[model samples]
Target: MAGPMISHSPAAPPRPGPGRRVVLGRRVVLGAALGWGAAGLAGCGAGREPVQRLRLATGPEGGPYNAFGRALAAATQGHAPAVVPLATAASVDNLHRLDDGSVELALAMADTAEDAVRGRNSFGRPLPVAALARIYVNYTHLLAPADGPVRTVADLAGRRVAVGADGSGVQVVARRLLETASLTGGAGRVAEVPLALGESVAALCAGRVDALFWSGGVPTPAVAELARELPLRVLALDGPAGVLRARYGPVYTAAEFPAGVYGLREPVGTVGVGNYLLARTDVPADAVCAVLRTVFDAWRDLLREVTAGARLEPRFAVSTGAVPLHPGATAYYRSVYG
Candidate 1:
């Protein structure tokens, strides 16, 4: 799928599509929209019984995860365990909170989830996490100074580069990109600086670093501000994108950054990584089922807030590589697809 570009002219969100009830062979039991059947089944599981509560870990304020999490929380208000969006440091932090039992649900980048499952990268040990659904795509941004000497990701060798801060998912993706670009752990490695999005922008504009790697939705406020202050150059990420997808999962894809977000006249070739809704494995299947039901049944409401949320494809839900589907989510899918 092409990386979604935010459209200035918003279209009315589409109504929730038909729902599936029972799977008899390959024929799907499409019936009365999403809620009719899902609503009935909501109380069938262990998720939202009476006053059961849940916390949804979202990205920092104003980020995509926060916005979508808020929409999701609102939709599930009377459905299952109460879901409250918890503003956090984003992907890596979300996963950490999920493992520590501080939160029951979270939003995380696919690569971050992959690393967590394998006990590599930022994660110290294997975490029992599973996919609730494959959500939206996060574009990988390789930004450099407009007139800087660096022209490509590989050229940053010996130059200063800002990955994200400690315990941030941006850092995980940044490190992976650099390793693939051959800019780390070698004779000509670049100088690494870790900072948050806003800080990275300031550092880049102030000449603190020659390049910065930011992975996020388009039109990130900080990047937009940086673009307005000085002409910026976006390095092409298509080169290493394929390798990343193969090493990771189909969650990573070759796509172009949307044009006009930063006053660009054309799209820039970049890589896109998906974000997922994850839950701890021990969550009741019925609860997972109820939440998934509410999520899709209220899908259109979410689209109104995050246009890219229209990409919540069902076929991709069960295939979130490296992580198993939560039993509740699996049950939901089987009932519909069986």
Candidate 2:
């Protein structure tokens, strides 16, 4: 029988008039070749052509996804397959790439991944993607000028808040959080401002925005910079810290932003969601399994090399909710944990 076919559609063009053209330039072809290489081990049957590369969709430069991708590439290189990292917009974009076959592997937020698989949130239809591993949890940090009046998540009502670029995971979760806190749809409570991560800090400093919500790893450069130069406070969500986990499923958990993690005077309680590695349903099982093995075997070393705070223990790598685990990755987890 022939293997499953994966489709690569053009990404929705940058916002403006009609969506931007989905450019299938040389990079797309290169990405496809890399993806094949990463999954090559599964095609080793007699008379099959050898696979050459694997393409991974990472996030914007300097973000946790990008760093993790680079580390993953380094760990997988020459062991199972040659891996290439394609920097993308972030979680939502990464999931779209995985669904459209633009890349074989991607990094996604558990919440966003849940929405895509269930067609519940931003994704209008169910997406055909599966999880390889749950890597780490992203703490939603609501950063405001330390002296600002916005002391809680609800205080941002009616104020200009940078929710990250449109279609980005930041925007998706920010809206959900606002609604959860009852800050949306009311007069003078919530104003969503779509801005890139790079521009969000400047916008806040210039007083164009009152607060900025970012979900990322510890010591993010943007967050650290803002904390150092400005009077910044990381706000605490209103409900109990574990409320999201209880209502939304185990994908979220209560996490602490330690006091002095970024020069804060005290620890701040918040909700967090995991980040997972994802792939299209059509990816070969053997290839996926090989990649999973490589990542797991090198988890500690990769964590040390990428970000000091990142923890890749096997205990934190299993998907808990709407996100479906890939068969190959499931095998890997069973082999290691069982």
Reference-based lDDT, residue 236, model 1: 82
The residue ranges of model 2 lying beyond 4 angstroms of the native Cα positions read 1-50, 238-243, 304-307
Ten-residue region with minimum lDDT total, candidate 1: 24-33
Q: lDDT tens digits, residues 230-329, model 1?
A: 8989888887888887887666778776677676778888887777899997777677777888887876676454443344546544447677666566
Q: Which ten residues in a row have the lowest lDDT in candidate 2?
A: 1-10
Alpha-carbon lDDT, every model = 0.74, 0.70
Which residues of candidate 1, in runs, are more than 4 Å off? 1-48, 300-310, 336-338
Question: For this target, which candidate reaches the highest lDDT against the unseen true structure?
Answer: 1
Per-residue CA lDDT of candidate 2, range 1-338, in tens? 00100000113233223533323222322333345454432232323333456789987777777877888888877765566899888888888887777888888888888989998767889999988777766777788898888887868878999998765778776777787777778685688888877789899999999999888766677788777889898887535445566667766666677788667888777766677888887776667767877786777665553334565544446533567666556545444443
